[model samples]
Target chain A: MQMTWREIVTAVHGMLFGGFFLMACFGVLVLLHRSLAAHGGSEVKEHGRRRERIFLILMVLLGWAAVLSGAYVVYPWYRAAVPPGVTNLEMYPQRLLMSDPHTAGWHTLGMEWKEHVAWMAPMLMTMVAWVMMKYEDGSEEHRRLRAMVGGFALAAFLAGGVAAEFGAWINKKAPVTGGRVITLSQDGK
Target chain B: MSSPREAVANGAAGAAVLAASLGCFALGVLAVAGDGWKAVAGLLTFYRPTGPLSGVSTVAILVWLATWFTGNRLWRGKTVALGKVSVAAFVLLALGLLLTFPPFEDLLLGK
Candidate 1:
């Protein structure tokens, strides 16, 4: 297997960090919902509260990593300026997409929305994690708090889902290619 | 089966929810502003490599954190009207989601 630094970073951003974060969002959302029940999942709560807290912390971290990598590392390469007289725009993913009327919408709609909207997840999730950490005991059944947390979490999920979907499609149409190639394995024949 | 009158104050949690929604709303507003106006776009280009995204996200995060800090401080021990706060939050969150869509942004900008 072989891949460029850009491709690898992009995969790590969209696949690893983003993928795990999405799963974690679902997990935390379920946990929050389950707690809204009568017992607060006390059996699970006893052992799982700490586990849930740790998961939440990790989720927030992954959310940050995904967006930061997407914006700072991969996006710079994706949007790199194509020098004049450069006939081939392969290295410039944004320009490559823009050059074609058919593919321009990917850049305009997919990328534009993803870049901004993806950010909301981490911000909201961080707050969700914080509130859960401080106030998530099973004692009071804080229904109002639980409902709001669930709402915020669901919003974050939708935002991440949008970003991930667009990112996958945009990359499929006009992949962010180039950078130093790394050989994963030589011909083992 | 907790008490009819709960113990913990809802203030801190309420602050967090409110601030997060406000931050989201700010991001939407800033993103639209950046897209609609050349001057705003240039000003928001904090990092050349990342374009305007760098500033938009950074400023929105700052708004979130600052509002969170202020809200936390002001409403730490006391209870808040979370019912009202939650309604506002959902509205803002929905608006944020909508504003990020390019078609919606363009419609509002008359593009």
Candidate 2:
């Protein structure tokens, strides 16, 4: 069976979101473990470091997937269908791309963030992971680096969630129909 | 026993792993952002369509290989400190991520 362009976009977008959501959640868990370790003593902290390392690896791989998938969807697939003289910014206006008109202010703000900030989670987390790898488990410096990376992961999670919502919204709002220019509301309402 | 010079050379190779890893990650960001010159230069994929992703992935894979090769020799069992340079580099990278985001752009430009 032949899948429609919309289906393809949707599937890829889903992968991007799923990967990011899992990574972000994992980042949070790592952070929580680290915080508890600060007070939980040496043995507990050692366990936290090991877990954090695994989570960091996972986050980096997920990040790679998210970035690559996002690029594939936007650059080659969606843009190919975009008409001449139309930029993504123009096709999907920032107001709509950033936020939903039907949503409350905070929800809109939250959505807006994904377009701008969500990509940073993996980059920052990877740096933290690399830094942590150099130091042995349960070291003071390792904990500090873990906390920092965890904080970035949380930031990424919020942005990634927003991005996933936007992807879903766009899939419905503007699908690629054959030989026709699709026009969607600037606000996606 | 290895000479002191050989030991220093190995340490440098090990350090290169961190640099390569960070470089690959940064290249990935450049791919997403499509920052003109860097994106084009980094485009290893050669296919015009999927250039950004291709370039980013190519660079990332190459860097990871280098890191893996050097992993066994890095730090010589001593503690690794990121030091001021590494810290500053990370901060700059984080700021780049934030600044390039649409919301951050709007926030900064009074949009």
Candidate 3:
């Protein structure tokens, strides 16, 4: 089996970074909900607090990694221009999708929306992480802070979901292909 | 009694949330601007390969950092009214989210 370099990068961006970011979003949601009891107060211990900070920091890092890889690494390949007389647009995802009317919406709606929306995830998550780091108590004041940041976390999750969904659908419609190929395994003759 | 350092304050959290929302809103506004205006699009092309996206994201991030630093500096250790801050932040965030939507953007630009 063989896979192109771009394919691997895209896979890493999607399956690894994007996938883990989504899971982390969900985990933070649950963690925050439990941390701030509805009646008021938190049950998180000191160790748990440290662990939470680590996770949130990691989540923020993952969010940035996902968007940066997608925009800088994979997106350049996706939006690469097609040379004249090159009828095969296989290497150009944006052009490929736009070539057909039926698939045009994939680029216009899917990619346009995904590229911009994905960014909200990291910005909001950064805020959520910093705020979580600050409010380290179980008082009513801290609980309200947790609840507000929890809402921000929920928004971050939705943005990530939208981006991942569109990224998957767009790639399926016109995948980014080309670049040096690597053989996964050699055949025994 | 809890010491000053030990007191629970909403200033930092408020600052962060507000700054993040402003950054997001800046991104949404720039996205729409870049899409609607050719001059804006060309101006925002910091990286030729990445088009306006690189500039858009970079500027928004800078705006976020600036606002966060300023807000933190001014609001740190002060217990500002969080309810008002939360309302403004969420509203800005909602508008930002709306502006980034393709259909909504089109509606604004008459595209």
Candidate 4:
């Protein structure tokens, strides 16, 4: 089977995006390790290590999400281009695609949003964790505020990503003309 | 028994390595953009992945590995500076990745 330009473009985009996201995830893991080492000592007396672990886990999970989304964006194009009978048809319908340019653009935007949030979430949590360590004598209100901010940021980032992915999926599945061709020629030329 | 001062120096060195890695990653991104699949294929598998951003990811992985090594060394030494630098590098790496996304790239290039 021949590869369409669209499929080729999408595949290239997906691979680059996926590779970057994977790097980001790896970076997050590095950061998580550093944060835990640096500030794991200062968490609340009863919940210190647990809190740090939770944040670390969250960072790691965010990395996985980015990687997964990146894969979703690219794998469809690969499958589409694969020769029939060489690959399973069951996989093709399950592949992700944005039916229109607008949807594709939005989904691309969504991936960016997800990546930014995933990056920020760990940094923010690391800051909060550091602060908790420094202000061991600080009030509960301050700690609560830090947690609230970090949690909110994470939620917002995740929501934006989910929305983008959903939008892309819906757009791809939207009913539309499957095949139509148009050509223009100068009169009597 | 490495002194605290020595640890700090080592941490700084590690941070520098990570910074360099990030720069390389950025360069790879740009190369992918300018040259497309050929650039990516050169960086990733030998099979020659096609398109502008094709194998640009392979270069990214290398950079990430370098950063991880530096950060890991610094963490082992318990240097707060190294930890901070690692976090900063990670943030930059993430930002760079986001910037390479098609939407952002289009906006930058007015595509």
Error of 1 at B94 (Å): 1.2
lDDT of 1 by residue, B32-109 (tens): 999999899899999999998999999999999999999999888777767778898899989998999999999999
Candidate 1: the clashing residue pairs are: none
Tens-place lDDT digits, model 4, residues B1-109:
2344332223433443344336434533554355344444454442232322323443444555566566556644344443445455556545564554556566665
lDDT of candidate 2 vs native? Answer: 0.49
* lDDT tens per residue, model 2, A1-189: 344555555465556544554555565656546553765364445676687678667767776566556656553544353456654433433333344555333223443344334444444445445645544345454455445444445545554565666656654554432223344445555
Off by over 4 Å in 1: A38-47, A141-143, B1-7
- Say which docking band candidate 1 falls in: medium
Give lDDT per model, in order.
Answer: 0.89, 0.49, 0.90, 0.41
Candidate 2 pairs with clashing backbones: A116-B102
The lDDT of model 4 is 0.41
User: In what order do the candidates fall by lDDT, top score first?
Assistant: 3, 1, 2, 4
Model 3 alpha-carbon miss at residue A188, Å: 10
In the order shown, the candidates' DockQ scores are 0.77, 0.17, 0.64, 0.05
Model 2's CAPRI class is incorrect
lDDT of 3 by residue, A26-109 (tens): 998987887775454346678988898899899988999999999999999999988989999999999999999999999898
The weakest ten consecutive residues by lDDT in model 3 chain A span A35-44
lDDT score, residue A93, model 3?
Answer: 90
Q: Per-model TM-score of chain A alone?
A: 0.94, 0.57, 0.94, 0.33
